[model samples]
Target: MEAYFIGLSFVLAAILYPLFIRMLKIKNIGQYIREEGPDLHNYKTGTPTAGGILFILISVLFGVILKVPLVFLLSLSLFGLIGFMDDVASIYKKDALGLKAWQKFLLQIIFAFGLVSLESTKPIFGVEVSRTLYNIFWIFVIVGASNAVNLTDGLDGLAGWVFITAILPFGFLKQDIFAIIVAAAVLSFLLYNTRPASIFMGDTGSLALGAFLATFAMHYNAEDALVFTSTIFIVETLSVIIQVSSFKLFNKRLFKMSPIHHHFELLGWKEEKIVGIFAGINLLIALTFIVYKMW
Candidate 1:
């Protein structure tokens, strides 16, 4: 029964995505590749962006179709809307840096604060942690996970496949219908999203995925599970943080480029190789986490 929802959403996405592509192309809603990015990616500019709207739509629809809780649907809408705003801004401005950093961060913090407040009274392993601290950690995880995915979107199908590895296990292991729906939908999107890509998910897909992941973690109180399943995202975010801090403090870069994947690209690694390597690592780590959690 659970698998049925996954398969249904997958088929829906696979069938509907080309239409979305044509619609975007007709509207000239294209991605703007960063000028500062790897030289190989320069040619990818102007691919129809916001391909994520397809999966995001289907995922939410499946939730509603299946009569998912109001709380989960609300959370999904909130985060997806935030990503949609950034994606729309990027389209009009033709700038990869959309909605400005501070604005996005503030929005994320506000959302995080609201989410944490819902469970503020829950005991933290028998310890009384301040509500402020709880909200801070949730904000850190939710926003950090959200942006980490944005950074990982450099290569075609990279973030999509990596996200599948992080998402699929939750449904089967935890019986989460929402996870199942999202994972399957993402896989279908990856069919067109693969190397020699047809369309990019842009900030819309990346941010929506991040928000979905963070909300799932909060839903199940599985923050630690997120660290293991989403290790690749964590590493990518850290690379950016380290690079920025290093360059600012010591006038040196921690990597050839931040977000690790670009650093490898600069070192002559192929996009396929980087995506494959990270996907494999993500699967291995997630499996290990599952085994440990079960033990």
Candidate 2:
């Protein structure tokens, strides 16, 4: 039954994406490129934005139909709402950057805190833990991962592929039903989100997906061992952090571009090649994580 649900969610996502594209009247809704971003991306202007909403809606509806816990449903919905707002803001501002830094952080903190409170007060997948520590740990995991994915969304299909990699190990663990459902929903989104994407996940998809993965990882208490499982997202976030810190402290650029993928792109690698190579690497890492953990 669970497997069936997973398969069904993916198929549904594949079908609904194009429909939503039309309904939202989002044709040629290009991303708001940062003035400082790579010169090549200037042409990406007028690509459709807010496509992430389709996947979010699909995932939530599927989860609800499967009767997932209210806590998880609420958490996912709240994060999706935040992403939706950010996406809308970006389109309105005509800037690639959506929410201001502080505004985003504030919202992330609020959602994370709310999710942590819910988890601490309830039994997650039948596992119990200290409420105080659980709440604190969840806040870090949720907010950190949510932003990590948001940062990784610079390239076509990069974040989506990385997310698929991260979710595989969790499915192998089979510790939480919600995790599997989320993973399935994400996979469905990836069908249209791959390289030369028909539609991008945008902030709406990335933020919600990140929050879902983070919350599920903590819920299953997979933190200590899932280090490799989340490597793609972590590396993406770290690359940006390192780049910013180096520039601020020593006026040095760490990578030609931050998030690592853009660095490769800047180095003259084709976008398709970079996506393929990184997706392969992410798969390898995820396989290793699963093998080691299950052994």
**lDDT of candidates 1 onward, in order:** 0.82, 0.75
Clashes of each: 0, 5
- TM values, all candidates: 0.94, 0.90
Encode model 1's per-residue lDDT on 27-88: one tens digit a residue: 99888887788789988888888888888888888899888755466555666677788888
Q: Which runs in model 1 stand beyond 4 Å of their true positions?
A: 123-128
Worst 10 residues of 2 by lDDT: 118-127
Error of 1 at 178 (Å): 1.5
- In terms of lDDT, the best-performing candidate is 1
State in Å the error of residue 15, model 1: 0.3
Residue 281 alpha-carbon offset, candidate 1, angstroms:
0.1
lDDT tens string, model 2, 84-146? Answer: 888888888888778888988899888888877765344444466577766776788788988
Residue pairs clashing in model 2 are 28-46, 29-47, 30-46, 30-47, 32-96
- Provide the clash count, candidate 1: 0
